[model samples]
Target chain A: MTYHVHGVSASGNCYKVRLALEQLNLPHVWHEVDMMNGATRTDEFRKLNPNGKVPVLVIDEKTTLAESDAILCYLAEGTPLLPDDRLERAQALQWMFFEQYSHEPNVAVARFILQFLKQPGDPRLPDRIAGSYRALDVMEQHLATRTYFVGERYTVADIALYAYTHVAHEANVDLSRYPAIRAWIERVRSQPRHVEMPGVDQ
Target chain B: MTYHVHGVSASGNCYKVRLALEQLNLPHVWHEVDMMNGATRTDEFRKLNPNGKVPVLVIDEKTTLAESDAILCYLAEGTPLLPDDRLERAQALQWMFFEQYSHEPNVAVARFILQFLKQPGDPRLPDRIAGSYRALDVMEQHLATRTYFVGERYTVADIALYAYTHVAHEANVDLSRYPAIRAWIERVRSQPRHVEMPGVDQ
Candidate 1:
């Protein structure tokens, strides 16, 4: 019973799961969905995930998990992605939560509005950009002293944040302003088996 | 080195950690930070958590964890709060993620704006309220069939969601429309050693 992950190639939410699976060296199939074609809204996909979101993980035909962070934690368990030390594990989760609450909502949403929605100069753009910068400043301050989000080593928490932060500049979020975060992004990119988001390498 | 959680009673995020501690019957001291007084902005508190958000769980003298969900996972680890089965664990994390992305940002933020910020019926209120209802609708639909958020029994996932949804009405989110969620709220309340959020019992 091979694991299966359903998502498109370009989604950061989906990239979180993909990065974890690859890092863990887990063998799985990528059931691609052309989200642009409205494949995710189809009744079949809705049955798999009622929220009709991407990056649903199906394992052994018995357990189907939705939400990218959940899928990352699920696959990363018992692996290096999760720390064995109890406090370190908690710290990893802490950063993961920050990724969701502070980082993703601002950075991802800003990128969505700018790139996907093509609303670069919309009235909401300024505030969204400001919010993204605030989040980046927070991350920059944290990463200023540490190599990873938690502990001395990389974990799923890093993967969760890296999924979107790396592409933040694409949305006009000037990474040059945050030297530490920019350096940390390079560190994450240099990891073994690390894969950049589609078209990013090209 | 006694375990200490740094948080105030009034915060739902803090309450989630406190509830987990009480549910597990873990002995811990509470070091309250008055966010209204800007205690969280202090340098010392920021060192414990660069994010400066509570509750920060300090275990022994060397280990400290931040983020409510992370603290919940940390304290619940190796305890009954965490599911042993891999699939069940994944499901627990899935709901935890849902609580963060779908539930908390809407429900909790609405409460913060209305209850604390005293901005109820503000121009932003309608959209925030609508978002909360959309999340509630999703949860109600899921709870319509299942007793708990994940497995047949309650897990930390329930504790995470229950922390906010139980008090959602105060934020103008009428749970009465969702009988399943309302009933599930009662079920969670009926649990042994259940602790209510501050002012909730009144």
Candidate 2:
């Protein structure tokens, strides 16, 4: 049976799952939801994910998974996206956690507020921008010596972090200061079967 | 070489790494970093983790892993904390993600502000309370039927969520409204070798 992923096209959280699916060459159907219409808050949709979040993946007949990182790990297992060495795998998950805690909450939240909520001047904006740069600066320093977030090989850790930091400039978090991060982003984008943001005019 | 974890006693993120180590019966040295003294911000510590975050796990002579969830996964691999079933493992990661995105930011941030910053009426407090409850409500509903967060047994996902929600009330986000969540918290704590939050004086 074909897998089904329920998500919005423009959501980076959802895009993470889509990018993994594309990279894995996994055939799946995309069921688009109009998040702006509160479609995810509906009773039926909440049944699939009580959190009312997007990027729910239904596999086979009996299994469904939520959380983009979970989905990424699930699909990437036994594949190149997950490292074979245990220590390297741990490093992969390390960066994934960093993306969730430091990167996503700052960069993604800033973008959400600026682009979606149109709250560029929201009192929280300044702190969010500051936090975003702090996170980026950390990433910049780390990437200065490495090509990927984990081992020498590419892994889903890069995917998780790349999902947002690639477009961080949209939120006005400057990337010019981070030359290595820019190069790493380009390296990630050049990977085979890479998928750009869903709504962008490619 | 013995594993070494650099952490602060009061940090649940650090506690998570400790708990996983204990559960796995891994012998390790605990190095305390006084965040209150700005120990983590030192150049020496920053060299270990550019992000200057707590819960850095040093293994062997050259391998170091950061991020609590990532450390948990690393130690728990080949153990019961992680499931072998593909879909079940994904479910475990799903809860880990929920803990990060929905649970930790609210619970941890609120606790940090109220306990450390001493700013109860801080403009961010109200939203933190609201968001915490929203996440708790979803967790409560999920636990209404399942004995654990994922699979039929306890996993790292539970450990990840329990580390924070167990102390959430200190932030004024009541779990009383979510009876199932309250019960599950007890169930997790009841596990053998379970470690209470550091400084709890239990």
Candidate 3:
């Protein structure tokens, strides 16, 4: 049975799952969750995921998974996206955790506040921008000497961060200074079967 | 070679690795890092982990892993702390992510700001407490009818959240209302080979 992913493509958290599915060539159907409305907060959506967050991956009929990075780990298991080497696997997770704790909270949330929430003047914007740059600096330094986040090979670590990072410009996080990150973004885009977020890349 | 864990006992994120090590019966040594000072920002620590976060697990002196949840996953591999079933493993990770994304940033940060950072009157206190309570509400609802975070078994999911949750009171986010969470905390504490944060118990 094919997996059913419930989330909008605009969210990096959601886009990570979509990117993993495409890279792994997994069959899945997308069910968009209208965040602007109270769609995800409804009782039906709550039953699928108690947290009421988007990007819920429903496997078969009974099994369902929440948390985009965890879903990426699940989908990329045994595939080249998730490294088989023990240290490499842990390193991938290290970057994934960084993406969630450090990177996404800054870039992804800033993008949401800017693009989706349409609150450019929000007081929180300043801190988010600062946080985004801090996260980006870490990535830039790491990518300076490495091709991918974890190993030299492309993996879900790339997919997880790439979803929000490549579009951080919308959040006013200027990438002009991050030459390594810019080059890495181009490398990610050149990957096979790459998919773009809706309303982006035509 | 035994693993060398670097971080102080005061941090919940660091305590998570210590808990997993003791529970899994894995032999390891502990080296405390003075996070309150500038220890984490030193050149040596940065080499250990670029992000310079605590709970760095050095395996066999060659493979070092950072990120609390990721280290838990690494140490718990092939052990009962991580389920063998595919879906269960994903579910384990799902809660781990929730702990990091939803739980830790709220209460843990609040605890740091209030107890460690020592800024109880800080403007961010109210929001952190509110966010912590919101995350607790989700956990309370889920645990109302369940024994553990993922499935009925005690797993890394429990370890990840319990590290901060059991000590949330330090942040002034009272848990007197969350009876389910209170009960679950007792259950976790009663597990075999249960461990406590350093300096807390004799």
Candidate 4:
């Protein structure tokens, strides 16, 4: 079945689903949403995702899943992309939640403000940038001792985090001090069937 | 083996773990962290969670899991609290992710700022409250036709969302307009072995 993905190409959350689908060799069709133009705010888009967020994976006529990380788990299930062990699977989810809660809100929002909204002087930028570094610090500390986020293997957890961290510069967050995360990012990039997110400059 | 959970009682994130344990009849010990006194910031707490967040579930001496939803998934695995079907599991995770990203950050943070930090005048409160209502609108729309967050049965998704949502008034966000959510909250409260999170008034 061809998965129908409604997303914005330049969005890291959307990029996560695209990357996983490519790596897993899943059949999929991408439908780009004009988020900046309020495409997601339309009633038709809200039917796909009531939250009006990007990266909605329509599995079939009767089934649609939102939330990029959840979509990753769905697409990665029974594949090498998802861990086999129960604890390891939970650990994978741990990092994904961390990405959404601690990392993305800071890193992704900062990038959105700067790249999409073009509002460098926005008041929320300082807190977002500072929080981005804090999230990076936690990631750096974790990656300092491991090859991957879970089970020493590349899993959806890695994909979830690598999405925004790789493009943090667009958020005005520097990675110079996070040597471990930098190395990890390269490792993620070198993974088989890895796909690059379209640069924000696009 | 008994699980050791380190968390703060007043935190909705931590209460998620406690509630799941109680309802699932799992053997666990709770170690309440003095978050207001900087207990999570201590070096010892960092060993439990580098992120320095609460709701750290220690499965054993060598294994620890952070992120409240991840812990819920861990504790709920193989139990009825987690769904058995692949799509249903992903659906459960979808709501959980939604809770973390779209719901908790606003609802939970607003509650924290007000009840815990006693910051009624905090500048972030307005945006937080507005975001909380937007999140509630999504939940209310979803719950308008469903008995639970997933599969018409109680799952961790409900547990995850029920944490902060039931206490949203503490965030200074009203629920009078969200009849569906209010009804669902009552349904969640009626679940077997349901435990109350200590009131902020305590």
Candidate 5:
């Protein structure tokens, strides 16, 4: 059965699902949500995701899943995209949680403020940017010794973090200091069947 | 091998690890970190986690895992606490992600501000409390028809959310409005080997 994805194209979180689907060559249909026009906030969208967030994976008429990383785990379960070793799998989850808690709220939110909201002077920007750099510092240190986030192979953990890190410049978070991250970003881009994320309309 | 966990007992994120370890009957040692005293900021702690966060699960001298939810997944793997079915497993992860992203930041942070920092009037509290209710609303809606977060049974998803949710009062976020949530909290508590979270020294 084909999967139906409800998402905002320019969003890094949504892009993560698309990237995985393309890489896996999974049959799917994408329906873009007009997030800028209050589409996600509507009653109809709430049925797809009570959280009212983008990137909802509709497995069937009766089953739907929200949260991009969880969707990633769902799609990548039996593939090489997910590791088979128990400890390696947990390590992958470790980075994904780190991304959601530490990285995304800072980097992705900063990007939203600058790119979507167009509020460079937003008082929250300072802390968001500072937190973005701090998250980057941790990623850099971890990536310094490894090719991938876990077990030296491409996995959903990489997809989760790569979603935002690749577009961090939109967040106005500089990446010149993180050579390892730069190398890893290029490596992710070079993966088989890799697809580029659609840029946000400025 | 026994798991060595470095965490702060009073923190809900840390408490999640403790609760899972206890309920699963897993052999583990807990090392309480003095987060208020800048213990997590020290060089030694950084060696355990470069992110400088508590709830580090050290599997061996060479391996360590951070992020409480990831640790929970690790400890719960192959057990009833983690679902064996793929979709149910993904659903478990969905709620776990929601807890870290939507629930903990609001409920746990507000509790930290009030109980630990003693900042009842902190400006961030209002927004945090509001977000806490939003997260609770989602949980209450989900739990209104189900016995647990996933598969009608206790899982790490419940543990992940129950951490801050049970003590939301400390965050100054009232739970009286959420009957479903209140009922689910008791259900979770009734599970075998359940342990009470140690209250903060307020």
Candidate 6:
């Protein structure tokens, strides 16, 4: 069955679901919401996702799901994007949780503030900017000897991180020091059917 | 197999795993890591979990998993605590993600700031306090007629949220404003084999 995804174009979280759909070759409809315009706050949007966040996946008329990584897991089930091994799956989810907690809050926030809010000099940026580097360091170290985040294959774990991390430069994150992460990014981009984030003008 | 859980007893994220283990009747060993004293920063601890976060589940000599919700999912899989339905499962994870992102960042951070850091008046308090209310409002509205976060049964979703939310009062969160949430919290507490957060003096 075709899925219906509602999300803003530029959001890394939203782009995560989009990337999965592309990779999975799942036929779906996209309804773009301008999150910057407070679209998610509208009552109509809230009815779809009470969390009031973009990236809601309506799998059918009866089932709609939110949370980007959750959507990724749902879409990737029974596919190569999700590892079949139980431990590998948990490890993938571990990194996904890291993306949401340690990585996104800093990297994505900085990107949102600078790229969208256009407030490079905002007072709240310093910590976020610093955190972006710390998260990158963790990823660089983790990727030092591994080709992918989990089980040596491209998985949703990689996609979950790739979403915001690929755009982290907009948050003023310097990717130069992370040789391994840099190589991983190249590897991910080299994957067939890779989709670029919104506004990349691909 | 008995699991080895490395965690800080007072951590809501850590406790989420413990509560699930209790509910699922899993045999496990608890090794408390004193996070306030920089215990997680120890190189020894770092070896087990590079993220330097508590709640690492050592499922075997070669298999250890981190991330609280991820650990809960791993432990709860195939058990009644995890919904068997696909849509219901996604709904469970959606709320778990919300707990990690929206609810935990605010409510747990507030509790950590006050209970652990003993700084109730920290400048970060205002925004975190405000966010706690906003998250509570969403939960309250959603729980207006529901018994659980998803599928009308107690699941990992409730466990993930209950860890920090039940103690939101310690964060100065005015739970009285959300009667639905208050009742839901009580309902969760009534679950058989539920465990209390550390430092509850139980």
Best by lDDT: 5
Kindly list the per-residue Cα lDDT of model 6 for residues B1-202, writing each as its tens digit.
8999998888889889888888888899999887878999999998898888889999889778999988988887788888878778778888888888999999989888888889978999999999998899889998998999998988999998888888888999988888888898999999998777768322
Against the hidden reference, what TM-scores do the models get?
A: 0.93, 0.95, 0.95, 0.98, 0.99, 0.97
Most accurate candidate by DockQ: 4
- Between candidates 2 and 4, the one scoring higher on TM-score is 4
lDDT of 5: 0.95
For residues B44-88, what per-residue lDDT tens digits would candidate 4 score against the true structure?
A: 999999999998999989899999999999999999999999999
Across residues A116-174, which tens digit of lDDT does each residue of candidate 5 receive? Answer: 99988999999999999999999999999999999999999999999999999999999
Candidate 2, residue B93: lDDT: 83
Docking class of 2: high
Interface RMSDs of the predictions, in order, are 1.3, 1.0, 1.0, 0.5, 0.4, 1.0
Query: Per-residue lDDT of B48-113 in model 3, one digit per residue for the tens?
Result: 878878989888655678899999988887888888777788888888889899999999999989
RMSD of each: 2.3, 1.9, 1.9, 1.0, 0.9, 1.5
The TM-score-based order of candidates, best leading, equals 5, 4, 6, 3, 2, 1
For candidate 1, what is the DockQ?
Answer: 0.75
DockQ, every prediction: 0.75, 0.85, 0.75, 0.94, 0.92, 0.74
What are the lDDT scores of the predictions, listed in order? 0.83, 0.86, 0.89, 0.94, 0.95, 0.88
Measured on C-alpha atoms, candidate 1 has an lDDT of 0.83
Better of 1 and 2 by DockQ: 2
What are the per-residue Cα lDDT tens digits for candidate 6 across A63-172? 78999999998898889998878788778889998999999999999988888888878999999999988889889988999999999999999999999888778889
Off by over 4 Å in 6: A200-202, B200-202
lDDT of 2 by residue, A1-202 (tens): 5779999877788899999999989999999987777999999998778899988998866667888888899999999899978888888888888888888888888888887777778887888889999999988888888988887878998999999888898788999888999999999999999989954322
lDDT for each residue of candidate 3 in A1-202, tens digit (9 for 90 to 100): 6889999878889989998888788898999888778898999998888888989999878778899999998998878899988678878888989898998898988888888878889999999999999899889998999988887989999999998999999889999999999999999999999988775322
In terms of docking quality, how is candidate 3 classified? medium
Model 6 iRMSD vs. native: 1.0
